[model samples]
Target: MNKENIFSMASESVINSDDKLALEALEMAKSKNIDLMELLSGGFSAGIREMGEKYASGEVFVPELLMAARIMKIITAEIEELMETSDMPKKAKLVIGTVKGDVHDIGKGIVCSIVKSNGIEVYDLGREVPPQTFIDKAEEVGADFIGSSALLTTTMVNQKEIERLLVEQGLKDKYKTLVGGAPATKRWAEKIGAYAYCEDASDTVETILKWVNEREALKEMV
Candidate 1:
């Protein structure tokens, strides 16, 4: 199939939560020599963004979004495996995880997959992650960004602790931070001194890309 056709089918797969169609698009991309990143970003991720919108509008619920996320994960894994031997330059590195006391993994997992698909190297710290672990791993990986997800009001304070620890360690300016989840808002991000508030996977990807571009531009000026 052609690029446009494959892209269309890939998008439909996510919207419909069809794993078979998603894998079919992956196969077509391989057969036609279509760049996997393009298929991921322009096709599957595009569909995922739509799902986010629909979920926000209450047209879709958690179950639907969860299924879509699963489909995304499958296709993304395939792309990641294919690109492993290829020299796809990473745009930036990010450490992402669910904050402490929150066992919710759906939102964090979706963010990790989508962000990684955008050519950013993501180190997923997994759910129930301690605030300090984020800092520790980011330090180890030399991460450019640290992202946290909090699905409950009580657990949200851990995200704040991450900010406090960064400042306490004199590393507040060393890395950008993103905060998000069902209970998180832009105001919450500002209150906690996070770099950006991401509402969904697509928003997280866009915000991170913007940060990466702005950082690159600053380097150019320097």
Candidate 2:
């Protein structure tokens, strides 16, 4: 097949979460000496970003977003494994979870993929995660950021509770806290004393990156 066809096939495989096809596309790209980074960043990341936008705009629903995220995970995992032996810098580590009493995980999963693609290590805590579990895992992993997602208005309050617990335990400043999901806002994050708030998966990366960079700058100033 032509180069464009091969790339298109690869992009489709990634969007569809077809591991076998993705592997086939990888081989084809290697044989044709195509730009792997272009394939990943342009083809794969673009596709997932499109789907994420659709989900955010209500053009697509949760199931579609979940499937797209799944595909993204499969494709990126393969590429990350290859990059491990190279000179590429590793990503930051983040602990993410859906707050307690919230069963919705599609938002968290999407954020995980976006963060992972940005070269961050995302330790996903799944759905209905308690505040203490988040604290424990953040401490356990020495994570750079702790992200909490809540889909419901009632459950969103738990994000503040998490910050309170962290403060009470003297771990409030140990890690940057980020709050997100359908019900989250900058005002809410500020009220909860969170370091940042994201409205979507892509924005979350920018927020985390900014937070990390700012912290590093502060450390240097010290």
Candidate 3:
């Protein structure tokens, strides 16, 4: 099928909350030799963004949002497998987590989906991740960025702790760190020495892309 048609099918599946139909779109993309990234950007990512906006506007509820996210996860896993066998340029690598003391994961999961849709490689540490785990994973993977999400005031402090440990390990300059979630603010991020603060998932993608591009430019200059 054509690109427009494929995107329409995928989006309809999302709007109707049909996981099976979403998987069908994924299979169709594979069979049509569509670019996996294009499929993700146009189909799954666009669908999820629309869903999120609807959720925000109260046109849809939490259950519907979660269902769309679940479908996107399935599509993403398939695309990730395809990426493994294809000769695609690797984008920035990121280590992401919901900080310690926070069991909330929906925000982090949404951010992860959007980031991965943009073609970045993500190492998700899941929820309730300790500060040292963030440092260790970022260091171990030589991550280009470390992203922390916390839904509560208590857990948000863990973002600052992560930065402190990075400095203590003498790795503060080795990676850029970004923070987000309901309680995160630009002022808070600045106070904690985070490279950037994103107020939402869309902002998170833009911020990381800018940071990645600037880093590449500096490397070129050197």
Q: Which RMSD does model 3 reach against the true structure?
A: 4.8
* TM-score of structure candidate 3: 0.65
The sequence of per-residue lDDT tens digits that candidate 1 reaches over residues 53-87 is: 99889999989988988898788777767655335
lDDT of 2 by residue, 24-130 (tens): 88778778887665566566656666766777788988787777667766666666555443343545789999999998775576677667767778899988999
TM-score for each model = 0.67, 0.63, 0.65
lDDT of 3 by residue, 1-222 (tens): 787788888887877778888888888888888876666767766787788689779999978887876777677666666555324365788999999998767567667766776777889999899999998898789898999998788889999999999889899988889898878999999999999999776788898888778879999999
Worst 10 residues of 2 by lDDT: 82-91
**Each candidate's lDDT (Cα)?**
0.88, 0.79, 0.82
Instruction: Report the lDDT of model 3 for residue 40.
Output: 72
As a whole number from 0 to 100, the lDDT of residue 100 in candidate 1 is: 91
Where does model 3 exceed 4 Å of error? Answer: 1-87
TM-score-better candidate, 2 vs 3: 3
